[model samples]
Target: MKRIESIKNPKVKEWRKLHKRKDRDLTGTFFIEGFHLVEEGLKDKEMVNEIIITEEVSIPQHWKLDGINLTFVTTEIMKVISETETPQGIAAVCKQKLAVHPLNWSKTLMIDAIQDPGNLGTLIRTADAAGIDGVLLGDGTVDVYNGKTIRASQGSIFHIPIMKGAIGKWLPSFSERKVPVYGTALEGGEPFNKIKSSKDFALIVGNEGSGVQQDLLKNTAANLYIPIYGEAESLNVAIAAGILLYHLRE
Candidate 1:
């Protein structure tokens, strides 16, 4: 095993760059940190390009290393490359894959420019729990490869497939397929329970501040609002998404 110590190592600098979307694009690689996440990447096999491990850690069995490179480093060196304040002993350089929707999409989630990484990730994790067919992101949303988004998703990002497109472009595609596209909003909308979501429908959750776009609003089959029981004016986007997803699941 090779040993690395200095934070100034050229390889370390290049690894740090993987945190940014621009860098991930330039290299076609993104970083995954922590034992469980790296394990999850191992499960996805093809998505992981390389694995980095502490010198003493054991590579688990049943992982098909085949042609993947494994780099070993000191604990201090591991810390230097990690994005979290509390570093995970392992990380990986994973290949970025384009998401493709399966032909049989029964229930789906559409994300529209959700700028906050935490919210987007939380919504994604929730979508997976609800057994969504796929996730679609509109333009202006945070890069799904960003470290925080990946971490917040708790590795669910790897488990569920995500696709991206302009809202105007994809909304029509859903419409053409006879899938009812619904947006969660406050005005000019029906109570979520009032509208029925079955196997062939997509739910759109928009930006933290702006909500859904007006143009998309015109094309929506239904705009949904969570009827407030208390004086609370609104719901956090992720929570609202979970509620909508749960309501639709049955």
Candidate 2:
């Protein structure tokens, strides 16, 4: 174990760098805060690069943190690396391990340009709860490792495969596999329930404002929309995703 007390320390500088997307990309690692997320990282030991704890906090007796790259830092130092207003006093730096190729998925959730980190995170957590096999984050989508996203996932990020890529290039693979790919649209989309739910499918959700890209929607096996019978003009993307994910899941 290492003890770091200074914010000026080089190791602390590197740890702070994990706070940014570019740094995370360049280093091939990201930091996760909160005990649950740290626990998730610790469970997959090979993925965790380091575990950081504030000196003021004590490790739970049940934790299996033995032999890990553990570090204790001052509360001030913990604040430098933490994103939360009330720092949880624990965080972990973990290697990015998204699968290079799409998984052979029974039910996958494809997303396009979802800008809100909370929406993306909630959708992902919902997908996990619904037993979706993987989540493919298409271009223009917010970074999955964004702190708000990681928090929103509530540790579900570790439960499923998530990757980022140009969705247009990947849509064909689903078709080639004879998997049904569905897109969400505000208009000109079939009522979501019209298509009988199935065992194998990919559902592509879109930006909060623009909905799915037109070209991508055209390529899907079908475009779907939940009817708005009440005065509500729209559904939050996260809510829509929860409804659609559960409806489409086997």
Candidate 3:
């Protein structure tokens, strides 16, 4: 194990930069905080570049960290790299796990312009629970590795392949492949239950305030809407995603 007692250490400075998306992209690595997240990263050894912990934290007995480098820093120093109010005393620097959709994917979730990290995380976790093959984060979607996004995912971030790309470009590929693409809409969409569910299909969920873009929705095989029974005008984007995903799975 290595010790980093100074907050001004050059390596510590670099790790702190990961809080910004540009830095994470440039370095090809991101930080995962908390015991569960770090544990999840450790499951795939190649994904974890280094494990960091405050001097107060002991390595979990179940973790196999033989080849992994461990760094111990003062609690204050850990705070420098942490994004939460109370730091969990553990974190890991993980390489980005690059993944892509296979040619024969069954269920896919396409997220478009979802700005809220929490909402995006919830949708990813929901998609994982519903057995989604993969998730595509569209042009304007929040960063999947954002601290809030990762925490919101509850470790599901490591359980699935999430690729970032423009929905417009991918929609055409799905069309070429004959995969049914469905878009969610605010109005005038076929009631979701009325549509026949399928094991192989792509569902596009839109931004919170603005539903799917008019142009992209045009490319879908059909548009779908959850029938609002009472007076609730709409559902939270994450809730809507869960409802649609499980129904489509059935």
Candidate 4:
């Protein structure tokens, strides 16, 4: 395996750039740190372009790296590229493989302008666990590849299909198919439990502060709200999504 020791190495600079959204977009790849995420990315070997591990770190014996590009770096270089307080001694640069179409989607979670990276990641993880067919990120939402988002997903990012675009563009298609799309809001929404469970549907959760976009809510089959039963005024976007996702899939 090739070894890199200099923090100023040209290749190290390129890897650092992967931390930025624009750079990731330009290169069509993102950086993931920690063994769990690296292993998850390996599940789709074609998408994993390179693997970087510190010289002191050992790969699991069962990991097949036959055709993969493997690189060893010094501990110092690992710290420079790592986003966490405690580096896991391993990281991988993987290509972005976003789902291109909405075909065969029975259940999906549509995120509208959610700005928190942690919230976005947790939502993706929850959707994956709830067996949602896919996730659609709407305009103004945080990048799915953000470091915090990737870590929060606990490697679920690789297990599910995710697409990003204007949420409105997909509404008409769902409308034509008569699939129910539910939006969460504080007003004009029925109790979430009132809606019958279904095998196919879409749920839209919005920005933490503003909730779902008004125009988008108007387009949904129904608007829903998890009733506030206690003194608490609201729920975290991620927690709210988990409750609704499992209920809808019941």
Provide the clashing-pair count of each candidate structure: 0, 0, 0, 0
C-alpha displacement of 194 in model 3, angstroms? 0.3
Write one digit per residue (lDDT tens) for candidate 1, span 1-250.
3557778889889998897789999998899898888888887888988888887777778667878888888888888788788876888999887686534576888888999998988988999999997888889999988888888888888888888877677776787789888987788998888876577888889999999888888889999999889998788999999999988875
User: Which one wins on TM-score?
Assistant: 4
Quote the positional error of residue 155 for candidate 2 in Å. 1.0
Best by lDDT: 4
> lDDT at 52 for candidate 4?
97
Question: What's the true lDDT of residue 86 in model 2?
Answer: 90
Report the C-alpha lDDT of model 4 over 119-231, residue by residue, as the tens digit: 99999999999999999999999999999999999999999999998999999888777779999987999999999999889999999999999999998989998988899
Consecutive 10-residue window with the lowest summed lDDT within model 2: 97-106
Scored against the true structure, residue 31 in model 3 reaches a CA lDDT of: 90
Tell me the lDDT of candidate 3: 0.88
The list of candidate 3 runs beyond 4 A from truth reads none
Error (Å) of candidate 2 at residue 157 is 1.2
Q: Which pairs of residues have clashing backbones in candidate 1?
A: none
Clashing pairs in 3: none
lDDT of each: 0.85, 0.89, 0.88, 0.93
What lDDT score goes with residue 226 in model 1? 90
Q: Give the alpha carbon lDDT tens digit for every residue of 1-250 in model 2.
A: 9999889999899988888999999999998988888887677788888889988788888878666788999999988888899998999998888967675887999889999999889988999999998999999999898889999999888888898899999988998899999999867789888888889999999999999999998898889999999999899998998899888876
